[model samples]
Target: MSITVSLLLWVICLSCHAWLQPGRYGLPPPRPGYRPALWGTRLLAPVLALLVTTRHDAIAGILVWCMTASLAGLVVACGLCFGPRIIGTDGRRVARERRP
Candidate 1:
């Protein structure tokens, strides 16, 4: 189950990378550090999910869920906060570079 969750998380990261490529990096070429951080965060999600799902105790599972949810929320908030910085001016620069 943990392996499955890991794979799913990887898939989600890959899809997000593909779909949000331009939006994330503002260029056709991806930045080197971007993928690692994104995938690392994604990889952690399944571990958290597994902790929540397999603890065998209701209270533990609930606590894990809350913690996982908080972590996920933090990840989203970080993305919201930093995503624009990555894609904002750099994206426009990419567009400008493309034009003659």
Candidate 2:
């Protein structure tokens, strides 16, 4: 349960961190009002996850947090890599140009 919570928090953390930098992902920039919220989520999730995991298990909480953080980071990285191809600027599938 704690691991699951940690994984979810890390996912939220990494996704927000990525979303905060829209140009890198080719994502449209979010409204200015959302920047603070995104920053807050990007910063808060990991700390909350740490607290939750530590409450669950003293000896293994750090280990669990590290494992889940790694897994969530990979998931987010793959999303960044493939997401642009899957969904373009106009929210449509990006058509591929063929070459002879």
Candidate 3:
């Protein structure tokens, strides 16, 4: 697959991961009896499989899989850690960028 396509897939995966934890960032809360995090965790397997299949050779396939995994994790972590501050309600930043 083209690098551009791969990047697009990674972005989608990341956004899905972020949506998994919507409440923390003030996006939206999860529904009752439904664990949003669990849904995303389950989805990672299929997404990784799709990403891996994009490459024909074993080496490239492995590399792509690893890359996708790392990027996905980073997205989830960043969303949990910095999402709210990045975009607060009412068009204002929830927290300042400077350290205090």
Whichever of 1 and 3 has more lDDT, that candidate is 3
Predicted candidate 3 versus true structure: per-residue lDDT over 7-76, tens digit per residue? 4556666665555655445455456555655476457754665555465776776676667657766766
lDDT of 2 by residue, 1-100 (tens): 9999999999999999878877655566789999999999999999999999999577799999899999999999998776544346556555455559
What is candidate 2's TM-score against the reference? 0.79
TM-score of every model versus the real structure? 0.35, 0.79, 0.45
TM-score of candidate 3 versus the correct structure, residues matched by position: 0.45
For model 3, the superposed segments whose C-alpha errors exceed 4 Å read: 30-54, 72-100
Q: Which candidate leads the pack in lDDT?
A: 2
The lDDT for every candidate, in the order shown, is: 0.51, 0.85, 0.58
Q: Tell how far residue 94 is off in model 3, in angstroms.
A: 5.2
Clashing pairs in 2: none
Worst 10 residues of 3 by lDDT: 84-93
- Residue-by-residue lDDT tens digits, candidate 1, 1-100: 5334434454454445443465554535446767676667656755666564556776655555555555555564455554433344345542233335
Error of 3 at 54 (Å): 4.8
